[model samples]
Target chain A: MTAQALHQHQPHRPEDGHKLHGYPPGDLAIWVFILAELGAFFVLFTVYAFTRLKHLQLFAEMQRTLDSDAGMINTLLLITGSWCVARAVAAIKRNHCRASAHWLLAAIGSGVGFLIVKYFEYGAKFAAGINLDTNLFYTFYIALTAFHAMHVVLGMAILLLVWKKAMAGGYSAQDHHGMETGASYWHMVDLVWIILFPLVYVMR
Target chain B: MGVHFLNVIWVALMVATVLTWLIGKTGELSTAMVVAVLVISAVKGWLIIYDFMALRRVRLLWRGLVLGWLLLTLSIILLAYWLGIK
Candidate 1:
């Protein structure tokens, strides 16, 4: 309803509204979607947390089998990515388009690096003769993290577009809509990793 | 015995307690300590949504979307409890 109202008014109205110099309304809409995705991921995280509390002993045993070092390293990688993307947003705000592009590239690079590490982690689990059907804990781990990897892929795609736009000087301090929305999505991805780290890696 | 090092959350909390003790000897069970940590985590989340996303001061409706996440969390826990029941 709100979208239809905005759409009906947008064509008739000139492009002279309170849009930031370069931020696009379409991008802001995407950010709202990212927030919704975060909502879903948090629901998953919350369920896992509560379930783990019930099966504390089993979870503790499961934790002992899992690769904490890989989890920790991935956590660090994501934290680094979060910082870089936050910098990218700040650079966009300052109209430093080139710097924003650089940060976005680094953030995208981290997404790739995360997947590389994740591949190895999954390989290790497979080599241990484990599969998603191994147990409830393993099932949740694979399902949630696989879903998370999809978000990483999505985030990388968004960052790539933002980087291209940045390089073209397409986003002005006022019009950098994609930057804000992309940052929101990346932050959601990082937030999920944060919860997963402590729950799946740290807790016993 | 060495499993103490395996559960990283325990180690982290233990480190936090020791560090807090060094700073002020505010040992564990101090409401100040537990509340302090929880408050920090919540604020960290707020910063992720508000600053990183630049939604620092969005309108009430937009803000409500973020708040809705907490409600979702509660519902998820309830659902999990039902599922866990046998």
Candidate 2:
């Protein structure tokens, strides 16, 4: 579809039930799913906190053995990636499909960077004989960060799909639910890391 | 114009991250510093949700749902941390 086709697209459709219901962005179904995911993480984080409190000294020592620099870099990557996704959504909202695709690609690059930093960080820990069974701190550390890393991979895949569709002019200023859905999911991943980084790595 | 706004937010988030990292590097387990870090995390989370996720444009109910969850999660974590410090 060309710019002309997108421009001809419905700029505003009140009957779509979105504005009628004063709905949130993206699919309402996605918002429900996103909340469920966040709820799971919330439970994990709460468990981590109380458990760490039980063994503060051990947690503190184990945390020090991890790589803060890598964690910091990964944090930066995810934040930038989230920003890029936001830009991608913004672009498509204005009927700029190609620009949106470009922004999605930039976001994907950030996702790749995050995974690379995470790979080396995990590798270093494993090489140090620090396995998941190492201790309490190591256990939650591996579990939380590893779970989040997997989400990053999933987010990347979703972003790739969004990118391919955007490149094909599948979204427009009026109908870009797919992009918002993917972007919302990606931002959740970023949000998880935001809390994880400080809670696990910095709050020692 | 919107892109510029998002860029400004990105910069703010980066600066906040760096500041938190520097504070962590101080190696201080002081309650004050921990509180500061948690506060920063909340702010970062809010920015991503409100702007990046575009929750600001949504209805009050949805905003409340997300932000309420955030507040609850952060408060619990902080409470646990404070207890651990004691």
Candidate 3:
């Protein structure tokens, strides 16, 4: 896990052509992946909205049962985490590896807070005998949020790996594509939740 | 991007989220309010794309593709809601 070892592990790929064309910070492949992921969520959200349109009363009632307070808190946590990720990228770009790692750790901490809040939120619902099969709204609610929770877990795993490499000094100002990739994915998770929070928890 | 710049974007996003919540609490499902919420969400999404994702430095094609997706999806959803609202 030494810096040299980590650096040597990533073989150079000159043909990658990532930043050659004025593109975003991350690997081009990842941007494509993010687009596909967002596309999937877009379909799911559309389905939820149109379905709710048909059963407006049921949707509104089930929405009231949700804890908007918890949703709002989770929204804050994810946004803060995303900000930390941005800072981490900025720090590494300045060749401040240790600072980058610190910022990433903070970002991971925010992710942990989000998961804990979500746990309690889901726990409360289950305790009240609510399940996906409870009704249409509950079904979409659990499905969309649970799917999103899985994405958050995946994003956290990516961040953890990035943090470990960062601590080993794997990333520097010129070569932090891995960190950028992980940060991009984390932001995608946050983005989805931003839209999801209002549509599911707040909108009537 | 500067740390200060990213922080500003983050703050803007937080403010947008609070406004979205407050507007949703206005106790009505009028088309105007729904469109407003959707517009705010689009703005928040763009801020993240441009700043946090560093899309601003990217070429116009890549930037346009992502931004196009956001607007297209939001427009479709807004249209659906508008149609179903009445």
How close is each model in CA RMSD to the real structure?
A: 9.4, 5.2, 5.1
| Candidate 1 wrong stretches, greater than 4 Å | A2-26, B1-40, B67-86
Residue lDDT tens for model 2, A93-198: 7788899999999999999999888888888888889898998888899999989999999999999998999999999887887787888899989988999999
For model 1 the local lDDT of residue B8 reads: 40
Error of 1 at B78 (Å): 12
Q: Write the per-residue lDDT of candidate 2 for residues B20-73, one digit (tens) a residue.
A: 888878884699999999999999999998888877757789888889888888
* CA shift of A83, model 2, Å: 0.5
Error of 3 at A23 (Å): 2.6
Native-to-model Cα distance after best TM-score fit, residue A95 in candidate 2, in Å: 1.3
TM-score of each: 0.72, 0.92, 0.90
Best by lDDT: 2
User: lDDT per residue, candidate 1, A128-181, as tens digits?
Assistant: 988999988998889988999998999889889888989999876666655766
Tell me the number of clashing residue pairs for each predicted model: 10, 0, 0
Best-fitting candidate, measured by DockQ? 2
The local lDDT score (0 to 100) that residue A76 gets in candidate 3 is 84
